[model samples]
Target: MSVIEEERVRGGVFKDINPEDEDQQPTVIESLCMNCYENGSTRLLFTKIPFFKEIIISSFTCPHCNWTNTEIQSAGRIQEQGVLYTLQVKTKEDMNREVVKSDSASTRIPQLDFEIPAFTQKGSLSTIEGLLDRAVAGLEQDQPIRKATDPAVAEKIEEFIERLKKLKKVEEEFTLIIDDPSGNSFIENPSAPQKDTALTVTHYKRTPEHNAVLGIETEEEEDDRKPVNDLDTMRNEVLVFNTNCPECNAPANTNMKLVQIPHFKEVIIMATNCDSCRHRTNEVKSGGATEELGTRITLHLTDPSDMSRDLLKSETCSVLIPELEFELGMAALGGKFTTLEGLLKDIKDLIVSKNPFMCGDSSTADRAGKLELFGQKIDKIIAGEMDVHVILDDPAGNSYLQNVYAPDPDPEMKIEKYTRTFEQNEDLGLNDMKTEGYAEK
Candidate 1:
């Protein structure tokens, strides 16, 4: 497209940008209808959005087959990282703030435990309230929530949506968080806080798995992709066969894939879903070496920057925060790749989410108090108010904890790696079997 033509497309969205281009027509591309085999039945209308740089809105429709679709595509280079926008909706005024949600953005209301995953809707320019309204509409048409077999579950979903509607009217207060791995989402900022609540935006690196789902591949990402011929890769990359669902004995398919972590190694993340019973299982396995002894690494976390250190905890890794007397094994935290702060937060959230008292049992007062105290310590550690030792022990030799200020070593940081005990090896199931399938001794 020519510069003037680009201006014409953008002018349609931003009137002030090109007032003299009133005679311009939308560019159309003719193609075969996707739904039907008919020729020259599909029409695509392209327009440029001014808010997002070089982003074009493509609307497609086929009159013959009545198939319609709308998507947002980027005409510019790929963004190096994802974007996250967070707004605290405390007043009706805040609800009026404009929002530009890309198709790849996911919405989350942590208070409600509700999430609208990416690819659920097309890109839109709307107010905060409008976004919530769309979310309510989506829930109404959601097959799983609307047609839930359990009456209580369906009713709960309905009630939660009603609360979301209240948010639009400023009758309720909740935090709205949007995560766009594609980095195409946006939220308006008025230079200062509208009321007592301020908007917070964060940009973070997206995992390779997310990039794969978004169809984004760069040279670095391509280099991290697993080769098809590797046996370990095939275990997670190939669909072995279809089998009956273990839950309902209905036919089901199991899908798995090898997701490589940038600046790190690959991992096999397997997932299985049963359509009949809706049974699902997801597991992450490391594609690293297996050694005779376990590995242990420790770091004294004191600065705020320390929280941003990269962490790769294999499924067999155990974590410890010495100051808080907190220790979680592989069974507790499982395999995860996150920042130090994120890992600490996850520990706190897990405690609260699983605590009987917090969940409404209310009988374990003593335990609840202890949990609250521990959680406070975690918060302090993350805020850099408290110094603590962070440790990772992995028997599988597949885990990693980057040296403080890694790729640049920090002199003040302490990181120690050591071997594991025979007892620890036994716990990792590394005992019993020999190379010849018999006792070595």
Candidate 2:
């Protein structure tokens, strides 16, 4: 048998076995060394991280030249959107946070104005300190040659390298940002299952230019090649399309349907399920154009039956609870069509369970107590044991709370319409949009 086959057989890395299985062992294979032009050994391991995605780690060692290289690659499909992670490094403990830097990801330190552009270095699974060490090593590697060629430039680079090294000590605060168009990179959240206050993770729709760089076709490009179909005519009919699962990145089908509420307008609901990971997600979106005036819906929860009221919160809607002094901004939970109780439960889960510093060793007794108390208040409100006002503010005026009295206005419910502010219009990208005279321009 060949060396690769023999190694696979000996390591028990079989095709029938799941590559992402935790029990799987690394497989060794012979390869050519680029530096020495000699045979080398490459060890490849496929593993899945807990609460994360699958990845492949490969390390190559040259026996003749004593050269070694390591790399990591995501074993999942590219995400539909790009991800930007902003981390606040304030303490030395922050240096221990794990980071998965993809080859397509760019790293930036805002304080030093230092950036490592995408494709400049191979992808690696390392901690923050490890990344800084690698950067220092890389800079030092070429310093001798630079010093002989240009002394002045070498001195500046040496100073910069020192600054990079000092970041590990975290003597001063710095912001580390990772922008990945492929969205496969990740920074470990020590507060798993909770929101990390110091770490902000934002997933944005990839721009056309970003998609082009990633070799992904834009929606406009795909529309040009395919015939356009009227979605309005297919209302009530479930449309199925193929997409990658957000959780596992496996191939899956998304089902979409347009449903018109009795008094409200049309809305589209989309659902996706992945068989490989058994992950499921559903989202709701407004099907109509932006309204001329923004809408604000307020409901007073006094009776237990108020929890049964159906509510539709658009992606552009912000939620506010006066009693709890809690305010959730738009896009926090995406669009959801659920009952009052369901919505409150989701909010409670988001604030209580997803809080990074609420339950872990990094948490303090005082802070954890406050969050725990806040969660109990939400439960009381949901149980109708407490009287509170729930407000829904939608800049696009697409959100709605079902009126118990259909023909007549409910006494406890209030609906107000007002002109959207310039900032709100700007947030919705309406300020830059020209409805007319665009062709002349």
Model 2 / residue 274 / CA error / Å: 5.1
Give a tens-digit lDDT track for model 2, residues 191-273.
53334678877766778888778777656433445543876666847989998776545578999999898799999999999
Judge candidate 1 at residue 281 and give its lDDT.
55
lDDT at 404, model 1: 45
lDDT of each: 0.67, 0.81
- Misplaced by over 4 Å in model 1 are 1-19, 28-47, 59-73, 142-150, 192-197, 218-441
Question: Looking at model 2, which ten-residue stretch has the lowest summed lDDT?
Answer: 8-17
**Model 2 quality (TM-score):** 0.72
Count steric clashes of candidate 2. 2
Prediction RMSDs, each to the true structure: 17.9, 6.2
